[model samples]
Target: MPPLSEILKTTTTPNGTPWLTSARVGDGYLLRYAGMADFILNGAGSQLTCWRVEPGVSADTIRHLVLDQALPMVLNRRGREALHATAIVTPKGACAFSGPAGSGKSTLPASFFLAGFGALGDDCLPLVEQNGSIQVLPGYPGMRLGRDALEALSAASGVTAPVADYTSKRRALALPSAKNFPREPVLLSRIYRVVRPKEGEP
Candidate 1:
């Protein structure tokens, strides 16, 4: 991996706070997430290397960024449609909830999980087309939820830890009895756009 010479791109939070910087390095790219970790992604999008690590950053925080953000970006570069969505498996197959940040994407899936639905993935749902149908690929074995949503769902027992020190969200395992983490891609059946309720609406 060569040194990141010049930044090709920089991404920010929904509120426009800078978070990630990317530079084209040789045939791949180097991504820098300030105060966390830097990842080197192969041009093929098949390999990821942790090029640098900042002291005191938890492994979980690095993992969260790799899976939830970095991986998705590279996958998109590889021509896969990586949606910012949460996928839940229902009797009808897989349904995805997609929206911008703070739009209940994870919370709605948490509710469905409590109701006995299996989860395919969260926050970076990858989709592949095969044999005339779109399939939803599985992501990490858990989802991240904010403190309030975790309390509302009564799912504290499954929480492994805080997703990162910078946020109040925690990573929680899918319910054991809910057929979690489908080993095979499930056919995508539908998609729903999720949004927060307007003022005075329940």
Candidate 2:
């Protein structure tokens, strides 16, 4: 079988950039970009999957893919359980982070991870209803953090890794575990909205 990178490079979309060209590995899809990669797994039959890529891809790019492409695909393909939220989860429901671009949504989640909280999602997290309760899909193994955000987190968490190895326009970073790198999808839970206050507005 061709390596996932080779598979992606071999395929192309109408615009020339590889859109949905990926290889199926186990229960997940390994997506390879020119300089980065991520995995998408089937979350409860929902086409939307938790995304984790090598540190470098822009968070804005991730947003565009998830919101513009992936989310819609899930809704159309798996309407039974559609989620619209950016969140992380604990044993008690889900904590969502909602905000616009560059609003620290990704940073907050990374902080949570360094603080020992499990990652539910970073850029695009799925929300679902289970047993009349809202649930969020535990996101992929890691997230992309901004430079300043990484520095702050390092100070707080007292855990530092080479940003050079995990830095990008979005400053990507992996969660604090190797097992969290799932080769499959996950279920959904709650949603959180992360945002930055307006200048001088509180």
Candidate 3:
């Protein structure tokens, strides 16, 4: 991996604190998440390398950042559309639920998994135009959820580990534990925008 040099882009948290930075390094790009991890993606988006910056950073956290965050940046640069959504493979095809943070994007798919429908992706749903239609690509087969949601979903038996040491969010396996997780692309049939119920509106 090439060494990171001058910063090229910066992404911040909801409260405005810098969260991730992208910098140029020879023919590759370095994506740095302060105190968490650094990822180097080659210019062609074919190769990737990463390491944790802080001690005690779990491999789960690094893997999460790489797939859910860094890879999306690379895909976007390659002209693929990545959405903040969760997709499930239903009888009709793939149904995607998309919205801002705190929406039911992740939870919705967990529920679908319980109903025997396979989850296609987690929070980062990547779409590809294929054969004159849109298709949903499979993401990592791990879903992160709060303790309460995890408990309700599967009695928390599928919980593997916390997403990060600093947070209580845990990853649950979506395959055998949750029933199914499709590995192949599914045709996109519908998209629903998930939203929290307004006051007194059910």
Residue 9's C-alpha lDDT in candidate 3?
A: 89
Candidate 2 residue 37 Cα shift, in angstroms, is 14
Clashes of 1: 0
Per-candidate TM equals: 0.91, 0.51, 0.87
- Model 3 over residues 1-202: C-alpha lDDT tens digits? 5566778988888889788899988888888898888888888888878844677777877878877888788888778998888877878898988888777688777777766777776888889989999999888767778888877777387546768765688777744424455767899999999889888998
Estimate the lDDT of model 1.
0.84
Give the lDDT of residue 55 in candidate 3: 78
lDDT of each: 0.84, 0.52, 0.79
Worst lDDT 10-window in candidate 1: 172-181
How many pairs of residues collide in each model?
A: 0, 21, 0
lDDT per residue for candidate 2 within 1-202, as digits (tens), equals: 2234334234555457644556555554554444444546463444545456656665656654554345544553465344434455455645667677677776776666666666655555554566675555555545656657767776334333332332343334445632444333344444556667778996
**What are the runs in model 3 whose C-alpha is more than 4 Å off?**
1-6, 174-179, 198-202
Model 1 quality (TM-score): 0.91
Candidate 1 residue 127 Cα shift, in angstroms, is 0.8
Relative to the unseen true structure, what is the Cα RMSD of model 3?
2.4
Off by over 4 Å in 2: 1-72, 80-85, 155-167, 170-173, 177-191
